[model samples]
Target: MRDAIKQLAESRSECTTRQTWYSALFSYNYPNSSETLRTVLDLLITARNEKTTQLQDTGLDPAVRARLQDEVSPLIHAHLPDPIVSEKGAIGIKAESVYQFYECDAGRAAVVFVSEILTAVTTELTHTGSIGYPLTTVLASAVGVHSRFLQASKKQVLDDLPI
Candidate 1:
């Protein structure tokens, strides 16, 4: 019947839309290249240091402190990509570009933590909506948060390291 055919077409269209949305969300969530992660990490480190210094200064008001903390917290949290290890026990996230800084256990832990966060973020985004604009916006927000968290974490690790 025409009604049945129409229903099938509609379902197919919905399915396609969902797929597209899912793909976009995942792509944004997982940086295709380690370079992307590295870039984000660098920015995060800078932000973390700046925020920490601001916090330490005596003149900052409570509102300013709150804002700075909010801005820096997410970047510190998002740097959690685990290193990809080879069969020979060589550990690295990418071979050439976006080299991971895993000289110590703290760095390795940061990567693992961020990776877990990414997975959780993707799942949360998928469940809250049907891969639509609202979902995309939410994912974008999460990406920003993760970026900040990763930066802060990196700074902490670097600070702990002996020069």
Candidate 2:
């Protein structure tokens, strides 16, 4: 029993093990895991980097250019709301002082901004692919890769578990 507990503890430290447990316990996986979020973000980043680099090339193809312009650029450049500093009274007086709320968690702010952009992309893809057909294709492929990674992770966790 002690050995079993120790083994379980050791396995829990593995990321795949934790992902499986999170999926089982929460009935959802990505939202609850920063690692999973990072995985998705990594896909976005890689696509952005590769395409942006290609865009910089002087001999870019017209079709690729259209795709990048219509699809990728808009998503990357999606506007997010500026942090509110304070609320003012009708008489133009400061209603109350605002703390350094926006300044406190810059990382969280970035994550929230990214999450909103991802949400917009997903929503647009689901509805009309209005972003662009090319972007939709790229997004679909990225999602396929991410799904495979998660499936492999879960399988690895199961394989590693004690019999």
Candidate 3:
């Protein structure tokens, strides 16, 4: 039992561990990371399912699959309301606060601000300790990947419809 719990905590060699992530997010006791990490896990499982179902034609190689699972496929929340997908008010507020706090509006110095955020988030969320490890990883990179996946899933479902 102890070994299993330890493995579970530190597993997901690709993604960051829950203990580290949760502690970074709030603290070891905060519950939000439970959902966040599980969501990431579920997304990975769904990506595997995609290979068997909608994305079979693409035939991703092992490297691509590992990259997608480990780096690019985690969902992200946009600072502005993402009405097209789903509305997460709390995340939206948090994102907005981050953007303003860092002054993403600070055009010339935006690089520093963005870099700081990317470093913090990546350190906490990815096992690689670097952005998109193997390629070019960033906090927002997963959003692009997952958005495309959602779009592909929609297309696949529509194609199956008789209409």
TM-score of each: 0.32, 0.30, 0.18
- On residues 1-163, what C-alpha lDDT tens digit does candidate 3 reach at each position? 2122223333333355344332112112211222332343345435444644533447777776665544323322221111111111001012222211111111222233233345445546566455446444545575455444433222111111010
Off by over 4 Å in 1: 1-32, 77-163
lDDT of candidate 2 over 38-122, digit per residue (tens) = 2333455466557777788778889888787543452232111111111110000011221011111222333333332444455
Q: After superposition, how far is residue 35 of candidate 3 from its true place, in Å?
A: 0.7
Q: Best-fitting candidate, measured by lDDT?
A: 1
TM-score: model 3 vs. ground truth: 0.18
Candidate lDDT scores, in order, read 0.42, 0.34, 0.31
* Model 2 regions more than 4 Å off: 1-29, 77-163
Candidate 1 local lDDT, 1-79, one digit each (tens): 2122223333433453333221101122233334443444455456567888888888889999999876554433222
Kindly report the root-mean-square deviation of model 3 from the true structure over all alpha carbons: 19.3
Worst 10 residues of 2 by lDDT: 85-94
lDDT value, residue 62 of candidate 2: 91
RMSD of each: 18.7, 22.6, 19.3
Q: Which ten residues in a row have the lowest lDDT in candidate 1?
A: 20-29
